[model samples]
Target: MKNYLFLFLCLLTQNLFSQENVDKKALKKEYFTTAEIDVKPEFPGGGEKMYSFIAKNYKIPESKEKIIGKIYIVFIVETDGSILDVKITKDIGHGTGEEAIRVIKMFPKWKPGEKNGEKVRVQYQIPISIN
Candidate 1:
């Protein structure tokens, strides 16, 4: 009976939170964007750099099995030449998603994207393979 009551209270509290102050504008901007990407990745060079950075910094926890798997991370390279709004579009579980985010966050500021040669927001994607 106590456990049931606790579970009910937890659910009820979550519902109340859902009704709390909501900034629909900020939420919309985060999910809906019209920004254009500026940089064309240098393919092997860019990917290789990302891989080396990840290998230098990321260590797959024991929870991840040795089988190779992939994670795709999405982020914005802001005009200040900084990485922001980073997240994993696809998760392989076992902390891969979280680790991917960490590596992206740790990256040195990139040469920010340009629109007509002026700095502008650009979206970037990175994929890391786990073994």
Candidate 2:
């Protein structure tokens, strides 16, 4: 009986502090993090796995020119092994922005970040270089 009472109080306290509004950038900082391409992995599909996935699935909107350039895309890998809040921090100005977003959205859910072993939201970034 005493244990149940303590548990209830703990739950109530946690509920009160849990913020409903989530800041994506701040959340990213809280999760286990790394930035910049550690090693230029010639990963299958241009080294940007997500981009590759996008290319594999998303048909580049038939609105781009024939100029090949690097498209810099920044996106969140998401805690549930999914991609979210994707955007082109820099655009090459040939419909690549739209294409980058399309590829990110197609990714499946990912392992959510953990804070002290608890599942938490995360923000991740990836850069796509289209040659």
Candidate 3:
């Protein structure tokens, strides 16, 4: 009888710990934009490196007329510094929008923004110029 009681108590303790873990995981985090953040997200190597990456990776599509314009893109920098939800706000023509998106997707993870000393997700915008 004593052995059975000990086994039952161990099972109960294990179940309680598992339930606590599940509860913690159920708390999903929310994302915010730079307008709402105290600290802005940054590229791993800073702004200059980000621009250099774009300049090196961006390729102008073949077209009859030279494509020269700017493409605006917005993406979410998550709490873990991974990018998500990339969108193009403005696009010129000749596959410029797609090219911009492709290049942005190639960007490495950035330093996540912070709010009240905690890492937070932030929406970031960038304008790519094609000439």
lDDT of each: 0.71, 0.59, 0.90
Score residue 49 of candidate 2 by CA lDDT.
65
lDDT per residue for candidate 2 within 3-122, as digits (tens), equals 999999999887766653344445555433433323221223443664557567755445446656666665555445565678788777667788777767766666455555555545
Could you tell me which residue pairs clash in candidate 2? Answer: 54-103, 79-112, 80-110, 81-109, 81-110, 82-109, 82-110
Model 2 segments beyond 4 Å from truth? Answer: 1-51, 58-65
Best-to-worst ranking by TM-score: 3, 1, 2
lDDT of 1 by residue, 64-108 (tens): 356469999888777676778998898888777887888788988
Model 2 weakest lDDT span, ten residues long: 34-43
Candidate 1 wrongly placed segments (more than 4 Å): 1-46
For residue 37, model 3's alpha carbon misses the true position, in angstroms, by 0.8
Q: What TM-score should be assigned to candidate 1? A: 0.65
Q: Which ten residues in a row have the lowest lDDT in candidate 1?
A: 28-37
lDDT of 2: 0.59
lDDT of 3 by residue, 50-127 (tens): 999999998888999988888999999988888888999999989999988898889899999999998988989999
Candidates in descending lDDT order: 3, 1, 2
